[model samples]
Target: MSQGKLSPRQKMINLMYLIFIAMLALNMSKEVLSAFGLLEKKITNANVATSERNVAFMESLSTMALEQPEQYAAVKRKADQVSEISATLDAYLGDIKRQMMTTLKAEDFEDFEVQDQPDFLDQR
Candidate 1:
């Protein structure tokens, strides 16, 4: 709008505008990060519940196999194999998570309240 130069008041107004916009952006990012943290917590809880249910089901299957070996033994064996594979994959993923936390120097994996920074994984 101004062709030549801006007045002192105009400069202050422009500076305040920039600061206001930056504050809004910062607030929005925090809110989004908080939402993500909540979602992560919910997913973790669900996983734990599902794991517990799976264990109970496996136990039931084992009992059934004991009662009727010819009918349920094969099914139980297959379930055990699947369980073993799942354990292996879980351990592998856990190791990867530990490595990431070590690299990031993070004390707690669930802590997401820290300020946003550039992607450290990208630096690697």
Candidate 2:
């Protein structure tokens, strides 16, 4: 429709339609951004909760090892390694989330409607 010159009224209608489409796109983008922000927040919260539970489990394992080395030393060592790896991974993921939020200048997921962390797809 925009390939060549056209009548003034047709051009006006095309411009108006383009503007309407742009408005719709803007609204959709905001909705999509809100959804992504909500998802990110949920994942982050889940990670924190899981990490906390893992830490507690590791502590209990350490206590068991202290109480009975013959049985739990190996188990505790394995648990320690698992905890280390999980902690490292959680830290890395948390850092990425923080960086994304910072880059987008978005508010914490505490408020979803205002979040702008919609650029999470960029691997950079």
2-121: candidate 1 lDDT, tens digit per residue: 668988998999999999999987665666877888997899899999999999999999999999999999999999999999999989987865666664445645666552443545
Candidate 1, residue 63: lDDT:
100
User: Which residue pairs in candidate 2 collide?
Assistant: none
Poorest 10 consecutive residues of model 2 by lDDT? 103-112
Clashes of each: 0, 0
Q: In candidate 1, list every pair of residues with a backbone clash.
A: none
Each model's C-alpha lDDT? 0.81, 0.76
Q: Evaluate model 1: give its TM-score.
A: 0.63
Residue-level lDDT of model 2, residues 1-124, one tens digit each, is 3568798998899899999999987675566767876787798799789878877988888898999999999998888787788779978987986776675443444565566445665557
Off by over 4 Å in 2: 1-29, 106-123
Q: In terms of lDDT, which candidate is strongest?
A: 1
